[model samples]
Target: MLDDTLRPAPPRRGGWAAPAALVSVTLAAIAGFLFLMMVTGGLLRWSPLPPGSPADTSGRVSLPAEVGAPGIWTPDAMAHPIPAAAVLISGNTWYADDSEFYGGLVGAGADDYRVLDNEGAAGMASVLSPDGRRLASGDGILDIAAGRRTPYPRAWTDREIAAQAWSPDGTRLVVTSRPVDDEPYAAPESLALLDTGIGAITELEGSSPGLDGWTAAFSPDGARLAYPAGGRIRILTLASGAMLDIPTPGGAMPAGKGAWTRDGQGLLTVAGEHCDTCGDYPVSWTVTTLSASTGAIAGPQYRLDGVYAVRVLGWWPSGRPVAVAYAPAPGTPATLFDDPGTQAGLSGLTTVGTVRVLELTPGSDHAELAAAATESIDVADDVLAAGTLRDGRRPLTSVDRLATGVAWFVGLTAAAALLTGAYAVAQRASRRRSPGMSTGIADSV
Candidate 1:
């Protein structure tokens, strides 16, 4: 009998290398395919939506980078007291875009609430005067402090104020209303407060204006009134009808759905300055006292949330209400953020300052992106980098660099696969050339 080794080893010559090559080819193909997918992957590519379809991992969903730590309310050099972005704040007043809900806006000055939908537009507004004089709305913009209704460029008249509540002293009432306007919803005719007290409501020729404003309030002394315009926060004095332009503490810009503070010295309005809106986030908070007379900002307060929703009691016997505050981060020293519109529009930033945090894009890893967020969803590197918001930093993923990395990996993998095939073929040829080779070549030459 022939020795086991010499028994013309049938075509049992196939080894693990053959299967191994197949795996390498599969792997090389997979690597190349994955790289392509990484570049052109995700729902955003084909959905026609904007590039960064915000998933909002940083506690803000209204607009990108809008919300901050909601529980922080104490005022200080570093307090994240404002609730950034828009919220449905339910209280004595309940508001709905449909007007079906029963409520008002004067309670919290939430009248500035804007839906984070296809547009920054608001549906209506519930306006109040400073001295508890007027409450109303219309296809026009209501100058809150002035207690005057100015016809809006757009005409939205169906919006209505669902409820109305007065401040402790009855000087102001929180009216539930939407503040922006659009197509059939022009004029922000959402909700409003028609001050039975204001002298100007008589100017609208009576009738309270625009679904007649809703839920109004008064300051502790009943001297000041608060309410919302489009994105404007208005504070008026009953005796003078003097309108005070209040600046939202952080990045929050009033849209409506707000009210007067306990002191009735300030007005509270839902505010937003999402990284999407601001396009960048400041590293610190800006505290400025604005002129109730001219919409001009003044004095510096402190740096809290880079962006947040703020409440202001217009005029206080003890001056502005000083909220006790603190920062969420331990090592990040607080610095005043900037508000450029502080003077020009009573809409700019103030108390400007800077922050330095890592950057991230909207489409980053599902788990890692949120972990990378510094404060809220509105917190962008550009928004939080420089104090003055001068195109601070870039958030894009650097597609070119990513592409280079993938190319390198694919090339290396292909080379390794080719080398394996060459080696395998050589080994088989060597065995066939040896006088001891018994396996016949499947494809003969």
Candidate 2:
């Protein structure tokens, strides 16, 4: 009879070959996908999705007068002018311990959309000049109409710079400077005024140590600067560098970046009543005005309800308060205030559901929606041109969709690689245990 061992080893059914092939295929597919995305992104000006019509078809883009003279902005014709009232929208990608943000400029009056390629993080708090021609951020200065950038002066290379606000004439920027190695949430070491025209910096007194996340604002006339520090609002006169400390109510702080009343007399700030012992979350929020000249409360404080938090961005031209409001998502715990230890701030509030830019009128509790987003949204404090409200929600742009797809692809590829490796290991172990099987078959044959 034919030896049973001489059955050709039954063709060695299911070795590592299948798994190895699968691993190779998965790697190749991932590589191809990344390459395709890169090429497509480059060709489409990094914006694969359509950005509605252009706001200005003058076909002539010019640098801000402060940066450069009027002329053709850049060789690339795709760069267009951004409107003054445009609000920045960010879509966030969260990892296990960190997150990345990406988005662009969008306006309510016109469908003017400009994608911010490299300034996704900095652009969130960037301030536009009163004239709406220049945009300033921690990175540098950008010509809103020309799509050009000017780097910060070389003297600032050793320090971290955070642009707080711009002077009324658009020639100067109020910025805070801290050592590069300092914790991001720590208060700034110094505050200075940067002359965008000459690239000069003038340091100011009364730096707020141990208090971070407070934004500074220039009075409407540009004579004084209002900022929160030491649990009070400090007004600094630019000419004499004299400071006035305006005490805030108990358990109250400057809401978002504080804004000056249109008449340049009072300061508008949001105050949150929180019971730290009970929970870090605020129980209620209010939009209150304080006298810029004195520390006393100016007008009646308006209670803002139905929202988790409200940040006073700036005042609309119509004398109404413009703000960005946050609401907790369903199933989100009430204790989910943003961890102050991390740079995530509002963007890291994973439980936040809806974000809306609203125009808060004094008498009515209902806010007029200027723009809305699912993740996060920010508007330049001084750039609410015409104070127009769109009353619409932001749609998912192409960048957001692409980011989501890439994230999924990476996750699946990693999982597949791990499984393939495990299978190969198991197959090798089985072969090692039965080392004599192949030899016996060959001898019988």
Candidate 3:
């Protein structure tokens, strides 16, 4: 027999050994990376969804410059001891998109923020109860303190439901429902009041053909509801089942949603001015106070300038007007408000810029910033009305950024390796099937 050491290694029966080894190594590397991330994340106390903690009572927190560097942020103090909460969306690399983001109560310097468990809860239109104990969404009610979710009753399960506004007493919710298969932009098929206590449903009349803006507001005392319908503000008295329609001025339309003044004497609606020459962008916006009794103009009509857009959230307990101020982000298009109709519609633009919760001071153009985020930030109407917002700060950590980069690298490497392995398998099989053919060149060791 020829020297055993020189015998050409049995011509390597299977070409899968190299690929198999590569796959095994890739798996081991992935597991090791995961373990390292876990350890580092724990040591850093950083997570996309952090657990709840007691309210921060150490006073207003002044955030560092990094807090404004495109990530989820929270305030360190509240102007007053009220249950104010907000939904914070991350602007970081990993959670930049609509599907991947963080959402929950912002805690408003009270308790540590809590993340919602429901899918797409981050983007859903949600409102806090008057007492701030519960949050209502299309899925159902979430008890904040108890951490429990109660789905809607069977009677309303067939239709797609969205929480519009909660009664001042928190006993009832104004909800809009549409057929499950209906187009998202299509008007709601019906509007109704759902009793939170007994799970009862009372459908409202004249809500068909639906409301134009898909948003409604309860008066301060919760006696009436105001919504935009058929190009006019429609006020419905809950007890009498009577309806009142207030027409908007020419060339002006309801902007997103409206809020009832603290005194309940007027309804606050954003009047978006249309300009044919201005292209798709709005010429200007004005927070018009319409009379509750008549369609006539009521109180101060503040012309909101120096901002891209504004949404009338509600009034603070101090009677100061509060709203969301949207400032154009770097690459924001001029057609930002081309479809200024509903809260859900406008929410799609949060990624277009920075959102600031502002308390518009009466008799002054200066607006005090309550809270802000680099991306989207939505506070509950009740929270804005009942609680006080103060300036506070928190810094963003590097752990999340590092983790995101590492995750991307690992994913790409594994994918490339797997593809290479598959190609090798295919080549080996082709060679085995064509065993009768021979190449002029011999295989090298």
Candidate 4:
């Protein structure tokens, strides 16, 4: 009874549908783009969000500004091609500190770094055993090829072992300890030698006072332990149980870890510039050798002219002392170092300019610039602060990550709904034009 022209209009979708759908798709694309931008904020260098985003979408975790000088073989270099915070060189292979908190062995020609894990292997403050087949840490000793860990002696359970060094024969460990049963563990009160074979412990006590609990370097023959006590180098002869204090002129304090020379005749140590008239902070530092026999200063005291702080890494195979030097961060007040509360330590200081390497020959009064690091070293700050381990980055809080997911979901859902609506409308129009399709709903007759 109704003419085709007058027939009831085919069901029309909402007038706002098309425009709203288009707007949603556009918004979704923008959101997806922003997410991508956030993901690669550092690589390509633009961020969609203003300076302060709820998430820490920022720079990439990159290698140190520069690699160590060629042939220098630094841990940062051995971690090469990746970055490592700690490295130990044993002969030809390099052991780097990886996630296990122990050393991960990697060879120059090897494909990957090796890690070890087992019951007692999980620990911190790692050092490689002399045999190169074992790795020792605060918790236990890991047998590299065996994938096994031997826990420390039960007697050390209640004590916090602060420092450890292996005997040259790989049969013993010299450790310093302090009790940690609830009370704060103070400077090491006891130094002991433990025979790894039988687990027997021997106390090294001759002067009543304990050696530096934080660090001790063994002589090449393992006959003595060289430590710092009250700004002087102390050599403890294990065979005779004698303690000798090496006097340093001008009240110079030991600045970093010391190592024994290849010949073991003198000890390598970095000394702080003595300032009797000044306050707590030393103005500069110098690398010098001390006579192993008498603890007397020997050789030239090579003072790094512009270096503000120094870390004596170890001795290179060629007997050159390997060290990392740091300069003050730009704009840091010159007076900052003078303030004890200003928050600069071995690990916390932010450095400006390229970190330079210094290799001083044992007897030289001057140092050779081994190599220059490519970029400034920022020791403490981290960039990938907002991803998950499941993702590539450290995670933001659960709520923030959830919100990011939801935003993505909503954008996509809106786009899907828009397309679905358009499809339904198109199907209706197609049926009307074909003339054979029927609206399934028939008249109530």
Per-residue lDDT tens digits for candidate 1, residues 8-102, read: 64465667778878988998988878676755543112111131222222431211212111111111111111222121111110111121121
lDDT of each: 0.31, 0.56, 0.56, 0.46
Position 353, candidate 4: lDDT? 35
**Which pairs, if any, clash in model 3?**
55-110, 61-393, 63-393
C-alpha RMSD by candidate, in order = 16.3, 10.8, 11.6, 14.3
Q: Scored by Cα lDDT, where does model 4 land?
A: 0.46
**Model 3 collision count:** 3
Cα lDDT for residue 53, candidate 4: 19
From the highest TM-score down, the ranking of the candidates is 3, 2, 4, 1
Runs of candidate 4 with Cα error greater than 4 angstroms are: 1-111, 114-124, 181-186, 205-214, 250-258, 274-283, 305-313, 324-358, 361-445
- Clash counts per candidate, in order, are 109, 0, 3, 6
The C-alpha stretches of model 2 lying farther than 4 A from their native spots are: 1-85, 94-103, 107-109, 118-124, 184-186, 205-213, 255-258, 275-282, 306-308, 328-353, 362-364, 380-385, 390-445
lDDT of 4 by residue, 43-116 (tens): 12211122121212142332122232112121221122222222221111111111222233322112123332
Using alpha carbons, what is the TM-score of model 2?
0.64
